[model samples]
Target: MNKMIALMLAASASALLAAAPAYAQDASYKSLTDKATADYKQAKVACDAHSGNAKKVCVEEAKVARAKAESDAVAQYRNTPRELGKARKDVANAEYDMAKAKCGDRTGTDKTTCMNDAKAAKTAALADANTGARAGTNVAQNPPATMKENCDAMDATAKAACMTRNAASSTKVAVEDSVITTKIKADLVKDNDLKALDVHVETVNGVVMLSGFVPSQAQVKKAADLARGVEGVTDVKNGLKVK
Candidate 1:
């Protein structure tokens, strides 16, 4: 169950970690953080009744839930790569804390192994967050105009190949993401089943992000399935908030 949770966390973070930068912090986010903190206090109060190791686990679980709620609120409010990276770290930290607490339930070397696994998971999540931060910084540094200038010197055939290169990030996954985004957009334009929906698609490192409002959950599923069916898509992040 813990492993399943970690895999889901990996998937969820990868998609959300791709975002544009925010120029200014907003009051709405402050309000959300306050609410989340209040909720955490209430949850902790409720968890106070449990005893011993159970009490510790309950406290950790409450903290984890609160951390997730707070992170989601931050990401939603800012929708920036930096904020997303922080959110990912916050979630990973919360999960790691819970995992460590759970390790108390184990005995001897088994406990050591569990703690080691938790550390590995935390390290991986932090590394991913760091990569996302670097990717965002690279995009900021390498403007599209510079890439266009570089491609301008190539022959028509060479330029055609070079055009597939991502101006955002130079990773191979970015190349696949570029083609996948274009194909998915084209598919949306021509597919009759998706006619009723207005979806915006973006891809970062082969993870497709579908935003904008959808008519229904069915439409959300349809859009996600369509993107998943695309050849280069590593994963689909359905952000289509239903109406």
Candidate 2:
């Protein structure tokens, strides 16, 4: 009957509509992956211009860029807040790895401090990411309970110092440095003239270190200027090389 044909056409339209979003998501995922791959390749090519510890650092930076891009792609495909938070954590871990690699170029107390600062930055970033994930799920945010447990093994005086140091490090300088680095990175990403992927940003005690590769001396100056403009950035160590 004519009514049966009308029903069939309506069902087909409904099915098509239901499939459209999934197709769009798949396309988006592919696009992100393609861009990530291209960026990784470009970053690796930049690494070819360096040697020794600098070369190692450059390779780690390239890996960090690729990890961030891939994680972002997955997060977009899932379209969930938790996935986005996980993507952030993934990027933090990549940055941590790169930071440790940079520390290999130092020695003694300097290297120790570098490693500690890197760990602190990672912890602050992970904590923020966890809070974001919980907030997205309508859960209350609290400092992880392990923070207290970690100090429990020490004696009274040591424990007090440990707790004080942990509290101060977590809530003050490390957090501020992380915020500055993030803002600078966001700014760089927004600037069309900068190859944001080719630059690695690291902050410690308000000092921002701009590393990795840039194409021109102007961009090197632009990056340092951008970092210096960020709030809480006391100084910029422009290690960015013109390639």
Which structure among the candidates has the greatest lDDT?
Answer: 2
For residues 9-72, write the lDDT of model 1, one tens digit per residue: 9988876665323323456677788888898889888878998888887787777767766765
Tell me each candidate's TM-score.
0.50, 0.56
The pairs that clash in candidate 1 are none
Error of 1 at 13 (Å): 40
Clash counts per candidate, in order, are 0, 0
RMSD of 2: 15.0
- Residue 163 lDDT (model 2): 82
What residue runs in model 2 are displaced by over 4 Å at the alpha carbon? 71-77, 137-243
> What's the CA error at residue 139 for candidate 1, in Å?
10
